[model samples]
Target: MFADGLFILFTVFAVVGAAGLVLFKHPMNGAMSFVVTLIALAGLYALLNAKLIFAIQLIVYAGAIMSLIIFIIMFLNIQEEDLPAEEGRFKYLIGGVIVVAPVGMLLTKAVNSLPGSEATIAGAGFGGVKEVGVKLFTEWLLPFEIVSILLLVSLVGAVVLAGKRGTNK
Candidate 1:
């Protein structure tokens, strides 16, 4: 009963935070909402017994990523003018459908599936930190490196966006 309650609470927090991120006019508030969503997701991960994922979600997203975002926002001195206005016309309805479609499809498919859900996810190769480390370093190493490279590119993009341009004079 307590778990169920916590689940509901966290899920509400997650949804509301996501909505706030999209609906908020301010970039800083959106970032803060994203943080709330990430933290709630981390809580969900912990509840599911995926301790490593919980830690990673918190450490990577809430800690490192949010810190980076806050730093960038502070450095850039974001104001009302810097933030983009929300798109026009039935955006909420459109956004609701966009978010619901894949999720509803996935849920429908899962409800129909006989093989996947019955198989215990907890026991399966969710393993732990050591197993995860081995796979991340060995099997997924190339993809991991590629992702890092992409992140580096994004970092460069952010730098270019924030930095003052050279004068033509």
Candidate 2:
């Protein structure tokens, strides 16, 4: 009962966080909302006994990635005057709603039509840290290393671009 309640609470938090992330005008506010979403997702993972995923969500995404983003934002020293003024923001929002609503309804309908599973419980060692570690280091190793390299390249590129911009000024 308590777990179910927490699950619902976390779900609500996740949805609200996601909405806030998209709706907030300020980039910092959006980033903070994204952090909230990540944390809520970690809670959901915990509820499902996915401890490894929960930890990675918290440490890697919420902690390291968000910190890096915030640092870049600060380093850029963006001001309100630097942002381009938007015309008819309301019209854009309405258009977004129009495009999203039908897609949302279609997804809901498709999910509802899927056959229900009989298993209520996860099988033994499901989402266990050891199993996940083994799989990550073995089968998923190439993609994992590729992603790391990509992130490193992106970081270096950001630094180089920022340096060039600073020197140009």
Candidate 3:
């Protein structure tokens, strides 16, 4: 019962964080909300017994991504007045359709399905850090390296973008 209650609370926090992410006027506040949402998502993943995913969620998302976002925001020196004006109401209408249409279709299809999804275990194998290491390196190596490279590129790009203009050209 206690676990269930906490899970519900975490879910609420995550949803509120997501909404706040959209509604907040300040970029720094929005970034913090994104971190909150990521942490709550980690809790949700842990609740599903996917501890590896939970750790990855916290480390990769809340730690690395949020830090990068905050760094970029500060480097760019985003002020309240520098923020762009909100688009017209039709923009929201278009955004709503873009977001809701696919989600509505997916939900409708999932509900109409006769059999719900089920998890199937893979062939017997070692469980834990060693197993994950082998699996990631053996099968998912390319994507893993790609993500690392992507982060490095993002850091370099941020530095370049934030560098002061040349005066004696």
Which candidate comes out best when scored by lDDT?
Answer: 2
What's the true lDDT of residue 149 in model 1? Answer: 100
- lDDT tens per residue, model 2, 1-169: 8988999999999999998987777788888998899999999999888988999999999999999999978888888877557667678888999999999999999999999975388768878899898999999999999999999999899889767866747
Instruction: Write down the RMSD of all candidates, one decimal each.
Output: 4.0, 2.5, 4.1
Residue-pair clashes per prediction, in order, are 0, 0, 0
Order of models, best TM-score first: 2, 3, 1
Ranking by lDDT: 2, 1, 3
- The estimated TM-scores of all candidates read 0.69, 0.84, 0.70
- lDDT of candidate 1 over 37-113, digit per residue (tens): 99999989877877789999999999998989988888899878776655663577587889999999999998887
Per-residue lDDT for 51-76 in model 3, tens only? 67788888888998789889989999
Name the 10 consecutive residues with the lowest summed lDDT in model 3: 119-128
User: What lDDT is obtained when candidate 2 is compared to the true structure?
Assistant: 0.89
Cα shift from native, residue 52, model 1 (Å)? 1.6
Q: Residue 3 of candidate 2: its Cα lDDT?
A: 87
Candidate 2: lDDT of 142?
A: 97
Model 2: worst 10 consecutive residues (lDDT sum)? 81-90
Regions of candidate 1 where Cα sits further than 4 Å from its true position = 81-121, 124-126, 148-169
